[model samples]
Target: IPHELYEAADVEGAGPFRKWLHITIPLLKPTTLYLMVIYTIAGFQIFERVYIMTAGGPINATTTIVQLIYQTGFSDFNYGRASAEALILFAIIASFSFVQFRFLSTDVEY
Candidate 1:
C-alpha cells in the first residue's frame, strides 16, 4: 500500500478504522488469496507430522489421507486403493483451490 493513499484518506477525514477497513483490507486481498491457496495445499499434503507423532495413533485416530495412502500402497500392498485415494485427494484439493479463487480473487493493482 502506498503512503499517499493513507494521506489522501486522512485528508478526506477517514478515521483509522475506516482507513484500515477500506484501504488496508482491500490492499491485502491478493496476499490473503495466495496464502489461503498455499496453506490449503500444504494442509492437504500433511503426512510426516502425523506419521511421526502417532503413526495413525493409539486407535487409528490421527491418520491423514497422505499417511493412509502410504499405508495402503506400501504396508498393505494395495496399490489400486492407494491410487484411488490419491486421485480423490487431488480432486478435493483442486475443488478447494477453485472455490477459493472464485471467491477471493480480484484484479488488484498495486
Candidate 2:
C-alpha cells in the first residue's frame, strides 16, 4: 500500500480502524487469496508431520486423509480401497483449488 493513501485517508478524517479496514484490507486481497489457496492445498496434503509426530495421535485423533490412505494401502494391504480414497482425495483437492481460483481471482488494481 502507498503511504499517500493512508495520508489521504487521514486528511479525509478516517480513523485508524476505518483506514485499515477500508484501505489495507482491500489492497491485500490478492495476497490473502494466494495465501488461502496455498494453505488449503497444503492442509489437504498433510501427512509426514502427523506420521512422524504421533502416528495418528491416540485413537486416530490426528489422522489425515493421506495418512489414512497410507495405512489402508501399506498396513492393511487394502489396495482397492486405498486407490479409491486417493482418487476421492484428488477430486476434492482439485475442486477446492478450482473454486478458490474461480471465485477469488479478481483483477485487483492497487
Candidate 3:
C-alpha cells in the first residue's frame, strides 16, 4: 500500500476498518482471486492428507479423485476406468483454469 492513500483516508476521517474495506481489499482483489483459483485447483487434487488421516474408511466417505483413481487402477486392476477417471479430473481442472484465464484477462484493470 502507498502511504499517500492512508494519509488521504486519514484526512477524510475514515477508520481503520473503513480504509481496509474501501482501499486495501479492492487493491488485493486480483491477487485474492488468483490465489482462490490456484487453491481451488489444488484442493481438487487433495488425497495424501485424507488418505493418511482416514484412508477413506467407514464407507469411503473421505475418498478423493486421486484416491479413487489409485483404488480403481491398483486395487481393482482396472486401468481403463482409472484412466477415464483421470481424464475427467483433468477436464474439470482444465475447465476451471480456462474460466480463470478468461475472467482475469477480461476483468482486470490497470
Candidate 4:
C-alpha cells in the first residue's frame, strides 16, 4: 500500500521522503499499529526461541509471561494461578484488538 502510494506520488513529482511523509505514513498508520500489536503479542508469547536458544536461563532473562505461566502450570504443577494468568492475558489481547478495530475502521463517505 505504501509502495503504491509512493509510486503515485513520484509520478506527481514528489520526493521520496516527502511522499512517505505526505502519502505513505498517514495511510500506513493503522497497518503499522496493527502490526505493532501483533508483533508485541508475539514477543510476549515467545517460547520456542527461548527454549531452543536459552531455555530461559541466565536468571530467566528470556522468560516471558507466557513462558512463566507454562513453567508454573506444567513444571511446578500449579494450574490455578496459570489459568488465572492465562485469562488475564486473553482479556488484555481481546480489549486491545477491540480498541484497535474500532479506531482503524473506516466509514464509507458518499
Best by lDDT: 1
Candidate 3 error regions (>4 Å) = 12-18, 97-110
Misplaced by over 4 Å in model 2 are none
Report RMSD (Å) for each prediction in the order shown. 0.9, 2.3, 3.0, 4.0
User: What TM-score would each prediction reach against the true structure?
Assistant: 0.95, 0.77, 0.73, 0.65
Give the per-residue lDDT digits (tens) of candidate 2, residues 1-110.
99999999999999999999999988887888899889998999999998999999999999999999999999999999999999999999889989988887777676
Q: Give the clash total for candidate 2.
A: 0
Choose 2 or 4, whichever is better by lDDT: 2
lDDT of 4 by residue, 1-110 (tens): 63666677778999878977876666777677779679757866778877889878899987878888898899989999999989998888778877777776554221
lDDT of each: 0.96, 0.93, 0.87, 0.77
Candidate 1 global CA lDDT score: 0.96
Candidate 3 positional error at 79, Å: 2.1
Q: RMSD to the native, candidate 4?
A: 4.0
The candidate, 3 or 4, that scores higher on TM-score is 3
Per-residue error at 41 for model 2, in Å?
1.8
Query: For model 1, which pairs clash?
Result: none
| TM-score, cand. 4 | 0.65
Q: The CA-based lDDT of model 4 is what?
A: 0.77
